[model samples]
Structure formats: C-alpha cells, structure tokens
Target: MTDLPVRIRPEIAALPPYRQGKQAGDEAFKLSSNENPFDPLPGVLAAVQAAGSFNRYPDASAARLRDRLAERHGVSPDGVHVAAGSVSILYQLTQAAAGPGDEVVFAWRSFEAYPGLAVVAGATAVPVPLTADGRHDLVAMADAVTDRTRVVIVCTPNNPTGPTVTQAEFDAFVAAVPGDVLIVLDEAYAEFVTDPDAVRGDAVRAAGHDNVVILRTFSKAYGLAGLRVGYAIGHPSILDAARTTGIPLSVIAAAEAAALASLDAEDALRERIDAIVERRDRLAAGLRAAGWDVPDAQGNFVWLSTGAETLDVAAAFAEAGLIVRPFAGDGVRISVGEEESVDRVIAIAASVVESLPQTHAGRR
Candidate 1:
C-alpha cells in the first residue's frame, strides 16, 4: 500500500464517503432523494426570510427549538438535541456511544447512512439482512448482537424498502435485546406513515427506556430538506453526550426559525402531508396493479425489488425521466414525488414491469 497522508486511519482511508442522490435536470422530476414534494410552507418561507440576520451566530444551544420540542414530547429541554439533520444526530449518537472495537447493529439496506456512520465512529457495522418481504428481520438483528455491540439503529419505514416495523415487533425486539445496548429509532419518515401498527419513537421513549433514542427530521415531513434541522428525543444524559459530539452552532438561525414556523403551521402542513400520503398510496397500488410485487409502502415512497434487474430497471426509469435511487444487485427505491411525477413514474414502472420476462424476480 502507498504511504498515506499524515497517517490517516487506514479504515477511514478505505471508507467511501456518502453519495447523495443524483440531481434531476430542469425537465425531469428528481425522485432519487426521499424529499418532500411540496415547497416549504409559506409560513416556513417567511420565517427563513425573517431570520436573515446573518451578521450574528445562531443560538448555539438552540434553546427555543429544544424547549418547543421538549414540550411537545413532554421531555425536558436538555432531552432534545438538535443538529444540521437527523443524519447528523445519528452520526453524533454513533460517536458518543461507540468507538474502535465497538459494534453497531442495524438492518441491511436501511438508510444508506447507517454503515457509514459506524465507520466514521471507528466501529464495526453488523447489518442484519432484511426479510424477503422488505421488513426488518428483528429476530436476526437481535441475534446479531454480541458483547461488542454498543448501539442498534432501526429505520422505519426502512429507507429504500418502505416497510415499517410494527409497535409490537419493536417491543418484542426491545425486550429481546440486552438492556445495556443503546437503540436509536430513526424516524425521519415517520410523518409519512399511515399504519396504526407502525412503531413510533416518541411513544417508545416515553415508555421509560433510558437506552432508547428517537430521531426525527424537519427535512422530510416539514419540507425543510435544504435547511437541515433535526432533533432527538431521549434520556437527557444520552442526548447530552450526542450533543457534545456534534459541531457546535451547526443548526443555523434560519433553520431554527423555519422549524418553529413549521410547528405553528402544522395544520396546513398536515393537509399537505395528507395529500402526499394519498398520492403515495395511489402510486403503490398502481405499481401492484401493474404486476409489480411491491412491498407494503408506509412511507412517501415504494420499493421495487428488481434484484439483478436493478440497474436495468433504473435505467428504464431514467429513460422515462424518472430518476430513482437504485441499489445495484438489490432493488430500486422510487420516492413518491410531485403529482405529475407520480403518473410519469407509475407509467414508466408499469411498462418496465410488463416488459420483464415471466422469470423475473418480482413477477407474480
């Protein structure tokens, strides 16, 4: 091996950086990233404009946002730790809880950010494979735990796959795991879930599990992806440690303001969310009706398990101006995007599904 720069950690040197979703052209709808389709609510936009006091640093502690969240979740202000994004909080929590020789467990093919976070934390990632139906294999995940295991992250409506862990399943998993192991429920897409059986982080944390932390973001449901504000609800001590590992003052004033404004405009936003949810359902149904064995899509997206056809399937989507996130050798995740984009995606997907040979993996 060649001599590396300033003795960078060999593993860090080998690790790949996070790859963002491909950007769409002006004529194409970008559904690669699981982002909200609606523009920021008018109120949120107003808040951002009013927060244009760029001359001063933001409140580093983010007390107002923290307190607001604390009240909503019925936790103390210190229990809420805000960051640039929920992914950032995930990284911070990883850093705070684990280091070299430690292991972090999560579902395979989950949020693409999971293994990357563990790598940066100098921890080993033990990714349990998802069930064939695209749900977390909770029993297998629990079995993967060893003494070196320090943290477990559960993402639901598991990204790229769209199946959510049920509250009962989550409870059973929690009961099965060791008490000392920290579990972070990544709920970035929680608001998009309509299933009554879905596991909700806030409810789990409220049940007095000191080892559990619930993560959420304003990026998805709140339509603040560009602004990057997210938070965690957990035991104060755990959150305090995560906060310390985070970049100080990283959550900007505009983001804080927009988050606050989002809360104030929750009713309006809920209506918008409702529309998206309806659209997501319609799209999922359309795909299934097209003979694609789509999974239970509880989020604002659907998972097309094309297996070996993943790349070819994605190319077909791109050819039709539907840019999707394709996990080669695995599947394609098509985010439920703009209303117009919905018809475009489903139409292209239907053609792709129909054109597939009878022997294709997803064919009934």
Candidate 2:
C-alpha cells in the first residue's frame, strides 16, 4: 500500500469502511438491506414535498420533531435529539463519550458499524461473541466492561441475527454496569419487533434508568430511509453531549417534516408492519421445514447460519432473483420483502439447504 502525503492514524487507516447491502437489478428483489418494503404514506409524501424552502438551512435543532417525539415518549423536548439517522447519532455518542485509551463494548456479529464507530472515536472496541443461538450474551458483555470502558451498546433483535434480549436480561445487564458508564440501546428495528418478552426501551426509561439512552430511527418501519431521520431519548445532560458532537443542520427540512407526518400516519404503517411480520414468520417456518436451524426471528428478516456454505448459498439466492446480504463464512441475512419474495426465497432455500454439509450448524 502507498503511504499518504499527510500523517494519518494507523488504526483509522487499517479499519475497513462500512459496506451497505448490494443493490439489485430491475427484475431482482432487493432483500439485502433491512428496509421497509412499503411505499410512503400519502401524508408523509406530501409533507416532504411541501417542506420548507431549500434556499435556507433546516432548523439546526429540529425543535418541532423533537417536541413531537418527546410527547410520544413522555419526555421533555430537551430529552430528545434527532439527526440524519440513528447510526449518525451512534458516531456522535461515541465521539462525545469515548476517546483514546477508552473502550466500547457490544456484541460481535451484530451491527457491522459498531466496531468502526469505536475506532473512529479513537477507542478500543471490545466485541463479545453472541450465543450459539444468536442472542446477545449480556452477562459476558457486562463482564467485558472495565475501568477504561466508556460505553456499552445493546442492539435488540440484533441485525443479521433476529433474536432479542429479554427485559430480564437487559435489567440484569444494566444493574451490572456502573451508572457513570453510558448504555446505548440501539433499537433501530424496534418497530418490527413482535415478541412479547423482548425488551422495550420505552419501558426501560420509564423504569428510571438515567444512564440508558434509547436510539430509534424512521428509516425502517416508517419508510423514511431515504430521508434519514432518527432520534435518541435520554436524560437531557447525556443528549447535550451528543448534540455537541453532531454535524450542524444534518437533519434537514424534508426529513423532519417526513418524520412528523409519519408519526401522524403511524396507524396505517402498523398494518404494513403486521403484514411483514406475518410474512417473516411464514418464511422462517418454511426454512425450518427445509431442515435449516433458523433463529427465532422477531425482526423483519431471518438469519441462515450457512457457515462455510454462505457464499454459495447467497449466489444461489441471486440466481433465484433475490439479492441477499452475505457475511463470507458466517451466514446470509435475507430481509422480509414483497409478498411474492417470501415464497421465492423459501423455494430457493429448499434446494440450497440440501447441499449444506450434514455437520453444519445451520443444518437441522
């Protein structure tokens, strides 16, 4: 590799950049990114179209959207902070709370962005392995924390793998950590969760855990992925620090308006969410019947731990006109998409599952 003209941090240079799911061709279904497959509600589209003049900067504070979210979550406007997306807020929080000589802990094989965020903050990343069934090992995560630890992130219905942390598990983990440490609950896919026992961030905050910060996004269930609006609910003091680190005017006018309109039309959106949930369950069942050990998927996706067969299986999916996300030797994550895509995915899986090694973990 060639050397840079200016001196750059070796760690930053060594880190791999975040990769998004592959885009699909015209005829293929894009089941790679965990995006909501529904179209924007009429109200939401109108709000974005009628948003403030493009000539001026968006409200630097996004006060109206903050106020709306605060009311819904039973917090003051100051307790809420909005940004381009929850992932951006993650960067801001890491920058605000951790730095050189500090550490950030989260589950490995979870969100692909966590490790990079820590490195970007000039902090060491401590990634605890998930359990064999794909749920977070919260006990191990709490044990990983140390004096140098500044932040702990818990991603529920963990991306790529769909199992969630229970309320009991979250409570126990929070009790294990010191109050001074920041606990970020990255619930980007929370709206897609269906399990009654899964931990809810709103309930956690209501129970009075000031150290906990709940991060949510309109990108998924609200179909606002293009606008990139997301927010955090936490103590004002904690949010204030993240705000200081945030890029000014990152949450633009159209995004804020779209978010507010989506909130108003949430009832209609839930119908769409319900349909996806139904489809996700059926798809998982079909894969299981085909002799695959699919995890308990509560989110709008399913994980097939194909192990060494990952690339081959993903290739088969693409050949079947479905674009899925693969993690080399790990597994493949196929998002719950159009009604027809579910049957198409399982139809392809029926053939691929048989070709897996008999001893593979994903094979039942």
TM-score of 2: 0.99
TM-score of each: 0.97, 0.99
lDDT of each: 0.90, 0.94
lDDT of model number 2: 0.94
RMSD of each: 1.3, 0.9
Q: After superposing candidate 1 on the true structure, give the runs of residues whose Cα lies further than 4 Å from its correct spot.
A: 1-5
User: What does candidate 1's lDDT look like per residue over 246-281, in tens digits?
Assistant: 999999999999999999987888998899999999
- Model 1, position 208: C-alpha lDDT score: 83
